[model samples]
Target: MRVFTVLGPSQAGKSTLVRAMAGLDKEAGQKLEAAGVVTLQPFSFMGEDWGAIEVAGGAENLAQAGPALAASDAAVVCVPADAEAAVLSAPYLRKVEEAGLPVFLFINRMDQTRDRVADVLAGLQTYCAHHLVLRQVPMREGGQVVGAVDLISERAWSYQDGKPSALVELPDGVRPREVEARGELLEALADFDDQLMEELIEDQEILVKEIYDVATRTLQHSQLIPVFLGAAEHCNGVMRLMKSLRHEAPPVEQALARLSPGGRVVAVGCMGELVKHLGKSVLLRAMNADCSSGTEMAGQAIGGLTMVAKGGNGSLAMGDLGRVVKSDHLRLGQVYLKDGARALPDWAQPRPATYRRLVTPVHQRDEARLSTALERMGEIDPAMEVTQDEATGHALLNLQGPQHLRRVIQTLKAEFGVEVTEDMVPPALRETITKPVEIHHRHRKQSGGAGQFADVVIAIKPLPRGSGVTFDDCVKGGAVPRNYIPSVEAGAREALMQGTNGHPVVDVAITLKDGKHHSVDSSDYAFRMAGKAAVREALGEAGLVLLQPIVKVAIHVPSVFSGNLVPMVSGMKGQILGFEAEQDAAGWDLFETLLPMAAQDELCSALASATRGTAWFQSGFDHYEEARRGDFGAK
Candidate 1:
């Protein structure tokens, strides 16, 4: 079965287009219709079984559509005929192109507008990497879009209200425009074919058969996009779309080639996992090779296999999405073969955790259950990060944003029956010494039979930031026994784990200068005690400094918001390193700076709000820097 993903901005009639094309609903013209956010529905046209994934619009749900895009054979990007609304397709188009999938541009809601087709096409050109060849030009009557001229067949069709388009003669004064558009289409195809270029350059006639072949080859390779238009709500031009797809859409083998090389059968994504009284089942799509119902793969029975089509319950074959039950080792996104297997490359890398929250189970007894549920969820989503902060003893959940975390929290309650509360994570702190100090400590004990006695003099000094704790033995002439020296260093290191400020001590150097050990009484235990006491005493005298982590941050956003960038960064006490034009992405800019970890929460919230959720950022821990007196009560 061939799977085509339908993508568009919110309210762009993507769901309507899918319904009309699939012959699901036909009467609801010119009204907003809400459908499933994500679903796979199979339809038939000319005895060919096909499926369409209708992805809900809006930026919030964009990340959720990754699975649909990865599983599809090709994609249809829907956009409105309005010039301004067409720009929303840029980001989505970039993703489809990156996946190496064949793309077809469908301009929806064309009947609502007239005489602005060229302007809308120009706006879309700024974003598309492939050349867009106009397959049809709009036909207007009484200043209303009534029909379109098909460039390839040199035929004109007029739309009847609520019915299939009827073929009509080329309208008067339309031949000049039709010839121009056809010429443009031929020129684009010629760029990839030498013979075609020669023929077009010499003003020679080209056969329709040759033209169709070149167009098919160019589109299959994703070098060019053939643009189609229709107002999907009226069902007008839907049949034409189905016809084009049947005749021109790249075959499933092309999708398999882009997914993996070689003749081996493979599976990339898990549509879902199900648990029943019988066993657990994993649904997956098989590519390039077929597996029968009784076949075994990776040591598991390929049972319960069925093609994802109209009432499909047959054995899975090449280019079919199906499922198998009771495979404990199977996982989503794992490539399966008859023997061993490997993992498929991720469609999109998990974005760095820009948002963090502290999660605690409300029932207290459900903590373990919550943790297990989070791990299972992470295995499926891969984008949600769950980690326990050893320093603060809080479970931190790292996700893309507030919306993402909200969904995770909801899943915890709905799926696992584990209730949890989320709050802002506090900044992690560190402690360091600011000055050097010298001290002498003696450990002594007497209990009649034996006594413990040890004396040591040590010097504590500060090292450069980021330099961890180090120990130096400067004892001369065997001032202290060598056997007991290791105990002294171990004691000092243990004390560094918890500093005077209740945080890990770092970037400090300790030197053991001189010490005394009695042969009869002195032992490793005595020396260790003396060492610990010495470091503790010296730390009290040394000036303690609280440190805060700084992060290197980069924000990628549209250049139109450049003016607000500086003020936002400066308000968070972040140092801006200036911004420049972003390469490859037009009208975008990259802002760079160093920001304290304490400012991350505020910065993330503000940037998302200001940019209407379009901007995104990445941050990494840079180094520990001294904190101000009022920043976190350091003094």
Candidate 2:
């Protein structure tokens, strides 16, 4: 059996195409409505069994598709017929190329479009690293694409509603177009074949079997991409696509060589864990060898194997996916061998979290339950991060985007039975002193038995940004006891934790100039009190300023939309560093900038709107800079 993953943007008919190929057209509509994760289905075509893994699409869910992509033998990229949707396939195409997986570009929903196939291919070619060769030319009737003429076989077919297309005579009007497309396909193949190049130059007729061999070889090597057209909703061109995959897609052994070199047994964890009535089943794919009950992989015995297909009979075979019901040690994206486990080098990694929100249990008593559920959620979706603020001690959930957050919240309530409230994350503001000041203070306590007395004079000075707090003792002649001087420094550092504006103080230095201590009443506690009081008084006279976190950002978008990013960044009070055309990704731009941390979410939203959800960015903490009082509503 062979495995292929279906990937594309959300609402691009990826699930519909999978169902169509699986001979489940009736369930296609129903499945699409609830499909938001990777789903596996098995089917046989032309006496060969195959598995179709449909990866959830969209920017929010793309990171979650990593495991499926890592384990598949080939990729079937479903693309909408519209030219505008071509850019949406950039990230997926990049991933496929990186994996070196053979790809079949299925331009779905062809029946609903009047655009030329060449136009759609042109748009997609800009983002694809491999040469795109159209395998079929649209056969239109009455201004509608009724079917397509296969360039290789020189056969024509008319699509039937929800059934296999009927073979028809080649139309005279389409013959010229088909010939030109076939020539283009041959030309692409000729680039890598001297014989084919010579044959084409000499006007020699090329054999169909030779063309097939070249197509398969080039595709497996990730040098050429074959394009097919269809509307999977009506089963148009579905059979043809399947037949092509059955012949051109690489086999299990080839995939093993490419994915796990020199390994005879390899299994990759996929989709995390699936909770069943029996137990928690870890979804995995057999990449090199068959696995069954009692099989030892990575030193853990496989309790049982349940194949993810109709009437599978609970057996796992090479190139197929199944559930390992008894393994407790496996994790998503882990590659297990007969003796040990290793990471899949080609596995896709989730993007960094850009949006965050504070989460709290509604009843306050389910805090522990929420924590456990979030841990489980993390195991399922590694892209999400759960953290706590050290200052505020508030639990926060970081996610890919707003949509990802919503889905996570929904899962928490529906699956984990944890109802939680969410709020905006508070800014991590800080304070810094403006100048130097000196102050003196005396600590005195009068009790019936013992009295405390201590005196200290300290100087506070501003330092450069990011310098943090520094402590120095300039006292001479033991004016302050050596043991008590350490206490004074400790107290001063603790006092800096909360400045006059209720934020941590940074980038300042404290010096203990002189102090007096009594022989009996003076103690660490007394000296500490004096140090705290003196530092507080000095800060009051030195003046304070608010500092907000700034982040370095790299924004990726199509070159056409690069102009919009300038105004977008400026609107958020960000500084643009530079921008240049991205290497290897034609027609795309990478913009580097410095943006305020508080505006990160807004930037994501704006880029999505300006680029039609085709933009993505990464950011990390840069440094703290002075913030305007009005910007943060701080007095």
Per-model clash counts, in order, read: 0, 0
Question: Where does candidate 1 clash, by residue pair?
Answer: none
TM-score of 2: 0.94
Model 2 Cα lDDT, one tens digit per residue, 1-635: 67788999888998788888988333211121111566777676666666777877877777766777777778999989988778888877776776778999999999998777888999898888788899999999898999899988899999999988999999999999988888888999999999999999999988999999998889888889999999999999998898888888888777778656776557877666435344345667787777777778887777777666444446577777677666766666567888877666644677667788888888788889888878766765667889986766767888888888888778778777788888877778899999999898999999777788899999999999888899999889999989999899988988898998899999999999998999989999999889988888888899898999999999878887889899999999999998999996766899999998999878878988988777789999889999976869766
Candidate achieving the largest TM-score: 2
C-alpha TM-score for every candidate: 0.89, 0.94
Top candidate by lDDT: 2
Candidate 2, RMSD to the unseen true structure: 2.5
- Displacement of residue 66 (Cα, Å) in model 1 is 4.0
Query: What is candidate 1's TM-score against the reference?
Result: 0.89
In candidate 2, residue 100 scores what lDDT?
Answer: 78
Give me the runs in candidate 1 sitting further than 4 Å from their true place: 24-37, 58-60, 113-115, 141-144, 173-177, 273-281, 292-294, 445-452, 558-564, 578-590
Candidate 1 worst ten-residue window by lDDT:
27-36
